[model samples]
Target: MRVLIVGAGSAGLTCAWRLAREPSTEVVLIDAGVDPGPDVPSFLLRDMVLPPPFYWDYAEFDRGYFLPRGKLFGGTSAVNATAAVRGHPWCYDAWGSPSWRWERCLPSFRAIEADMQFGAEPYHGHAGPVPITRCELGGFDHALGDAYVRRGLARIADHNAPGHLGFGPFPTNRIGDDRASTLRTLLPELRGRPNVTLRPQTEAVRVVMAHGEARGVLVRTAQGDEQLLEADRVVLSGGTFGSPEMLFASGIGPADGLRTAGLPVHVDAPEVGANLVDHPYVQMGIEVSDPAKPAAPPGKGALLTFELDGPGHLQAHAFAYRTRAVDPSADPCSAAVTCALLTPESRGRLELGTGRARVRLNHLSSDVDARRMAEIVARVADVVADLASEGALRLPADPWWHADDLPAACRREVVTYHHPVGTCRMGSDTASVVDEALRVRGVERLMVADASVMPSLPRGQTNLGAMMIGHRAAEFLLEAPPP
Candidate 1:
């Protein structure tokens, strides 16, 4: 069977790698980004730098904030900070699907990572393609950890450890100085595999549908020509934005919106681009005492995950890192701590604007979210104050977190953790865009295997979870009877 997969990101690449191994199955992987092959560019390899050519410029359209997503072969994983955090066990169990329960998802998670620090543990895998290592805490990180300990928080080294919390080193998908993106890990192995076709620089315009089945994809070639690539199955791995956009462009979203946009409606799935959830964060800049002091390694930082009293016992995490200066005149030595609300109650939506997808991440729109975000900021501020008292750094004259109207301050300072999910949410219910198996509802021969299909935001970085979805998608397809 020939399968055409769109978006060669974390999920797409993983699914392709797994499906290509089956000698009888043919996999065609396409992406709008350049195919760097094994020799990825230095900019893409470097952590904390989101190069323009490799990314889809959301253009500060999401409430005046930039939402960066990779447009390259490896997708966001190739350009992200190489964080490899897994979600809390309850995050999966809350999906309300037996196939996605924590117990069922653990094996796929283990099968994707070779944790250098905890490979021997029953919960981790030592033989996976991606290499996972915990970052070493620097002096500042140690100070931050000390503050958390003083606040009665325990130190948990492994954030990926089931339901573990508190201050610790963040797990990263870094192999030495380079990032272990699928472009480096899975792509290299899939190279020259006869059954796989890697077609980069190809933009998927829409899925070509007929009689409620996805016959193929209509892609715009790199040469500015349109082409139709047919397949028995088509999987949309274009991430939260890209996947939903693909569905909208294919005339398979809310009927009213599709009709207003002058597109034919194939399926009136209202949730196609709804249920957008992301970790809302606010960054507090810290001016160091010594500007000449060298910074810690990129992708290396300490994380403090804690719980807040909410209806769902909401979670949050704060991490410190040296901020990268995009402007030439800005101080490159400045560090920043980001306090993010992991389990936010706010919901956003993705709509079609002209020919592209328009995103509105109604972050902190919920009263619960604003209140808890303020609480998180207040807690993080205490830690920052401790650092300032020790003369390690200087704080802003009027720190936003220190404002009397903290919830309003949080609203003003809120930004994305750069982790967006649930655009094409999956569930057992009819309103969901896809089923528990990741298959797009009402559409045969089509599946969504990426962050887009997540029913809700998990309590950690989504890079690793996205890879697990891809692995599980391949298994689901493989186990099912062929059409």
Candidate 2:
């Protein structure tokens, strides 16, 4: 059987690698962009230094913003922060899908990760394609860990551990001296496989469908010429924004939305571009009084999460980090810390623009959501201030300590964590585009296997969740015996 995977991101690359391992299957991967240039630096690999000559464009939403999602061979993974985190157990249960529960999905997460630094743990898998490493702790990580413990927060050895919670530097999908992106981990393994062909600089315009089934794809080459590729099955892994836009252009979204663009409707799936949700992060940066010396270089730090309680709120997810905490003296110039409210109550949507292929996100549209985010920021600020007051840490005597000043902490900042999800939600309801197994409810031979399919936001970061979805989608496709 021939399989075609679109978008060479983590999900697309993972699916290709998994399927290519099967002796009887022929796999082909297509990407709409080229590889990162030799002169370009990766955010994860370049010692957390900002990449030189930023490659992509950003789309401004309401108040918050979206980064320029990569369109390269490795997708955003090639340039993301490389933080590895799995969603909470409730993330799956709330989706109303049996195949997505924590128990069923944990195996896949284990199968893809080869954790080297943290050693063998029951929840961690040792023989996966990707390498998971824990950043060696510095004074900040130790101080934060100690503070969390003193405050009666649970002490977790591993955040990736199922049902585990507490404070620590969550494991990263970065290998020694390199970021463990799909390009390096998954795609490299399948390089010599004859059955798998990677075609970069090939933009998929739309899914070619007939009689309610996906026949193949229409693509635009680097030369700006149009071409068609026929395949038995079409997997849309173009991510939250690209995937839905392609589907809508192919006449598969809401009839009204499609009609506004003067396109004929094929599959009247109104929910294709609706229900978009993202983890809006409110962050604050505090300069340390006595900045620690960098052991390696600047931009090395660990990520820490905390659970907060509010009136009528059972639990909320918030995270923090002391920049330069990984290698204390990495940057001798200055030391800073950043704290973000990860699971803000704010939800957003992705809408098609009047022009062709133009997409915009209505981020932070609800005032209630904004207030929730503000509360999280206020809480994080308080925590930092408390730690400073106790002499556990020292905060610079700066006037910009308020949560409202978060937007100015970093220049041109945005929230993606590479976790844009829920644009193509899955459920039993009529409004959902896909079913439990990631299969398009009303279409044949077409499925979405990326973060976009997440019905709701996950608790932590989303790299692991996206890859797990790819792995599970492949399993379901193989077991169902695609026709």
Candidate 3:
């Protein structure tokens, strides 16, 4: 059987790798951008950590804040900060399906990571392609992370351990001197394997549907030639924005929206480009005067987790280095802490623009979110006060920090964590675009295996979760009877 998988990102790579092992099944993986192969120079590795060539440049409706999505083989996992955080267990339980419970998802999670610090533990896997390393901080920075441990929070060296709630080193998907991108790890392992074709610079424009079944996809090849590729099954791993936009362009999605865009409606899936969610983030700058002889650390460390009302409600990620030039004369060292509301009540939407995907990230649109940010900021102020006493960290009494109207400040200061999910939500409900098995409703041999299918947001970074979705998709397809 021939299967076509569009988008060679985190999820797509994982799914394609699993299917390529079956000699009876032919797997074709396609992406829109160039891969640059495994010969990336070490000098340029740090620059590669930031989004550039593969990023899809998007912006908020009014704020014009940049929103980027990786558009290449490894996708965002290749460009992200290498954070490997698995959210609190309740994050999965909230999905309301046993198939997606934390217990069920943990095995896939284990199967994907080779945790350096916790490989022998029952929860972590030691043989996966992805190398998970624990971040360790030296010097004075260790004192700061330890302060939280003293505050009665559970001391957890392993962030994935049961009841992990305190501050320590962050687990990252980095292998020694390099980032563990799927192309560098998983894809390389599948190279030269039979029954697998990996093509870059090939864009999938739309899914070809016939009699309510997915037959194949129409594509624009690297040479700018348009072509049709047929397959017995098709999976859309194009991601949060790409998946929904592909659906909209393929004669699916809301009838009104499709008609207005001069496209014929097929399935009339209204939820195709709706229910967008992201963590609302706030970055606070800190300055340290040299004359004060403040203790400064060398390496970055720790993402402190907290519970405001319930599990994994909020998080604080802080860096020890300077972010901006505070004063030119003194050349004071500066640092920053990023705080975010994890379980946001706000919802956003994605629309197809003339040149790009238009996003209306209606951040802080809910009263519950406003209150949560307010409370989170207040708690931060208290923590900053204690840290500032030794002159190591200076939390300036900025207008936003001292403002009496905090709710209004929250509205203005909110930014995305870039963890968008739910564009093509999955569930058993009729309104959902896909079922519990991730098969698209009203379509045969079609599935969505990306962050877009998340019914609700996971209360942490989404790269690991997205990879697991790809693993699950492959299992479902393998277990099903062939068409």
Whose TM-score is greatest here?
Answer: 1
- Kindly list the per-residue Cα lDDT of model 2 for residues 16-86, writing each as its tens digit: 88888887788878988775544345443544433433334445454434365766766777766677777
Worst 10 residues of 2 by lDDT: 293-302
Candidate 1, clashing residue pairs?
none
State the number of backbone clashes in model 3.
Answer: 1
Please, what is the whole-model Cα lDDT of each candidate in the order they appear? 0.86, 0.69, 0.78
Flag regions of model 2 displaced more than 4 Å: 36-44, 47-58, 64-66, 117-119, 293-300, 310-337, 342-344, 354-368, 387-418
Minimal lDDT window, size 10, model 3: 291-300
The residue pairs found clashing in candidate 3 are 322-334
lDDT of 3 by residue, 1-483 (tens): 888999998999999888887888899999997777767545333343343666877778768977777777788777666777878788888888889998888888888889998999987889888898876665435546666655676556877675576677777888765668786778886677889888899999899999998999999998999889899889999888888888887887888988988888988898888999988887666665453433332122566677787654454334343343222243446655667887888999888667667888788899888888888777766666677786556667663766798878878888887899999998878999999999888888888999999988876788989998998888888888465
Put down candidate 1 lDDT per residue, 46-116, tens digits, no spaces: 75666578778674355766677988888899888887778788999989999899999999999989999
Q: Which of candidates 1 and 3 is the stronger one according to lDDT?
A: 1
